[model samples]
Target: MPDATQDAAARILAAVRAIPRGQVAGYGEVARRAGLPGRARLAARVLSQNTDRTLPWHRVLRADGRIAFPEGSAGYREQCQRLRAEGVAVVDGRVRRELMAGAHGDLDAMVWGPPPR
Candidate 1:
């Protein structure tokens, strides 16, 4: 039987994995979706302790759609690079609001890979 920590980590990781490619969700939203509402810090903590390189950690951002890493940090640069590789526009270290997972017309962008221009 898994301990509570393991269970929580599993739920958190699963929620993170559910975020589709080229899309991003806030830490709070991920926590909410993981059945652990109001535990955004737990989500961040679990992610910080993760060892799997395959996890899409870059797809998670702050509530305001900003990168959580400090500016000029390696993590911040890596996150910006990863997001841009997925066709997500990262301006001044923040994902464009219209491109966030729950934003308006996000379904169209997610399904069709953003409109040209």
Candidate 2:
């Protein structure tokens, strides 16, 4: 991969690491936190190739607050289990909006420092 791509992936990983145990962020939100607006797909792609299992990969989700894994699949079950274990309500495969109320809808600030809001 190009240096830019590698750098972006590193940034995304850093942002993923910053997500608190009980909080989750959409892929788009993570991309924004990585300083790459409108690059949600890039974040997902980076996650697919992620080797650092220590990163909170499961805390990243679709923009609609849905887990990307197919429902009923092992990955899906794992994602749901991991999220619920973090106290993030996973209802019908979608995380509760109440838990995401403090979300960062804009990309003007560094989201990884303070909790997104």
Candidate 3:
């Protein structure tokens, strides 16, 4: 049987794997989906130690839709490139919230910000 750590990692990995291509999820969101709310740091840790080259780790981002890597870093550039290849609009290292995976709120409001008076 897997230990608690292993189980948590498994669940987190599964949650990450479930994020569809051309979409993205926040680290906190991934943790919540994996039944480990408030474990966003754990999610990032697991991804950092990931050995599976096939895992779509780049699909996970900060809650505010920003890439976690420092700007101008190789990781940052690669992440941006990967997301753009999937048709996701990335601007200044920030992804549009409307393009985030599982987003179900008001599309117009999210895409265009608050409506004009």
Candidate 4:
């Protein structure tokens, strides 16, 4: 059985997976949605540690629309490719915030899950 922290991380991953294609949420947003405010780094760490191949891990990004993975890395390339395939516009290796804004309707609902406690 997973420890409490592991279980929490799993739950966070589940919430992240719920974000639809063509849409992305910020790391801080994911943390807040996972019932762990101020734990954005923890959320990122959980995603990095994830071994689940099916998780749409590419759909999460920094708040500035920049890919979270390091530049020139395989993960960075994969993230760009995934976003492109989903019709999200990425320019100069960065996603345009305007494009993301248009793609993600109901912005608050898309990023934030429940009301923060």
What are the runs in model 3 whose C-alpha is more than 4 Å off?
102-117
Pairs of residues at least 3 apart in sequence or in different chains that clash in candidate 4: none
Which pairs clash inside model 1? none
lDDT of 2: 0.82
Summarize candidate 1's per-residue lDDT along 49-85 as a digit string, tens digits. Answer: 9999999999999988999999999999999999999
Candidate 1 TM-score, C-alpha based: 0.85
Model 3, global lDDT: 0.87
In model 4, the runs with Cα more than 4 Å from the true position are 98-117
Model 4, residue 66: C-alpha shift (Å): 0.6
My TM-score estimates for the predictions, one after another, are 0.85, 0.84, 0.85, 0.80
Two-way lDDT contest, 1 vs 2, winner: 1
Candidate 3 residue lDDT tens string, 24-96: 8999888988999999999999999999999999999998899999999999999999999988899999999
Q: Higher TM-score: candidate 3 or 4?
A: 3
Q: What is the lDDT of residue 90 in candidate 3?
A: 95
Weakest ten-residue segment in model 4 by summed lDDT: 98-107
